[model samples]
Target: MNTVPVNFDFSVSSVEVARRLIGVTVLVNGVGGRIVETEAYDREDPASHSFAGPTSRNITMFGACGHAYVYRSYGIHWCLNFVCREEGHGAGVLIRALEPNTGIELMQKRRGMETLRLLCAGPGRLCQALGVTREHDGMRLNTAPFELLLPDQPVAEADIVAGARIGISKAVDIPWRFGLAGSRFLSRPFGRSHK
Candidate 1:
């Protein structure tokens, strides 16, 4: 693939950014892979962390775009999100899953498993496999330990799938989830009419 001098313009809507991230490569210290699944959330969305306004945990989401908003999920696993929209917009795209393409051995070791498909199949799992933690929060995506490389070409719209986000009680029907079509690495399969 052709590597170009490009940066993700996170000043757009979270849904737009999430959909466009399908084929991008997210390497956390050279350990990530093609982005396969993502979910979008905005300040107005009830399911968004910023819906209730900025808090200590979600302040990063209100900061400048193109920054990391890492947070712990269920008091256990850490989840990674890319802050999007304009400054103080409080929008972000959650990186739900990835197709492991680099540092396979290291990822397997970190996750304590050898299954390739299972290594980065979920947000928490992906974070664990790539060593993403609180330290990565508020960090610039273009800086060290965070290399978000654009795809050689834009991913075709026909090759993408959309669906409702997973594991959320509110806004359960909003079609904010996006993923590469037929990607086995998705956190979960898209449901009917979700495309």
Candidate 2:
């Protein structure tokens, strides 16, 4: 219910900047949605998409800060990403999951489910629930309507845990993924470290 002041929009050029998005809150109001769970994926890391360098699919990541870079995976499953770092920097934060709040009916209708966990539980699911599509690519997060607003109280780095990214085979060696600790809203526990 509390709105926080807008700081310098995060520069999406650096992977380190993207990895720090763990505690940030993503808000979608037009559809009556508030998402809480997220996992940060830094650039420069071999596991990151930007690490392979920017392509037409990833150009938004190389642009200015505070924007969306929604993309589809395997010709299905739309994934939501938040641009990070300064303009021209090829870094962005991948929103891996979310905890739904508000508009249970709308979310359920969109997702075609009634279970609480099924609504906005994973990146693709979250995107589906909030009506995020490829059309939302490159939208500014700090502008209005749709934005990734950080809460007045951050979850803190110490409280976050790191582990290998899910559903990725390449660069699994890099431990750059970050998520909230002990949150059922999280996609899954990352081995024993997360427990």
Candidate 3:
């Protein structure tokens, strides 16, 4: 069993949290699925919203750990992230993709499409499908409207892959992006060498 500690401790580094989240099932008001892809970011990373310090938009990231940091990408679709590390540490894991297994019909209705793979393949699409928006920012992940459950089946280490993050101009080569190996639900394919 892959047990490198799966307590969802947000006090750890963002990288560790991102890797551990791979097989975890997440539900937002009873609509979500197993997290398949994620990207880690900290206050020191230039690509992170917290790199320059806390702002009104990124203030949630600086708050307590294990909370939602919802934001809009390109002024359009909302993206969801899980804040990590200590309070005022400004670190989080971007929830990039999911293998949706719950509330499939509702997700299809909200996304306006019937394709299962495309429903939660990307951060923006995942948020839209789960009805996550700015309203969820700063909300605790352990409370109502959110449920993060440990995997029933332990995930194997060899099944996880790492690569560079996508849609960013800075810190492009950090290789902080993590995903479940061989999962077709990923937002984008990882390079062969990433494994």
The best candidate in terms of TM-score: 1
The digit string of per-residue lDDT tens for model 3 on 1-195 reads: 222234668889999999989999888888999999999999999999999998999999999998999999999989999999999999999999999999999999999999999999999999999999999999888887888888878578899999999999999999999999989899999985365
| Cα lDDT over the full model 2 | 0.68
For model 3, the superposed segments whose C-alpha errors exceed 4 Å read 1-6
Ordered from best to worst TM-score, the candidate numbers read 1, 3, 2
The CA-based lDDT of model 3 is what?
Answer: 0.92
As for candidate 1, its clashing pairs are none
Mind giving the per-residue lDDT tens digits that candidate 2 earns over 1-195?
Answer: 333235634743334544456556666664533333444555556656677777999888778777788889888899988777667766666777676766768888999998876677778888888888888898877655575556567667667777766777777755556667766777666664431
Q: At residue 143, what lDDT does model 2 achieve?
A: 59
What is the number of backbone collisions in each predicted candidate, taken in the order shown?
0, 8, 0
Candidate 1: C-alpha lDDT: 0.92
Candidate 3: C-alpha RMSD after superposition: 3.1
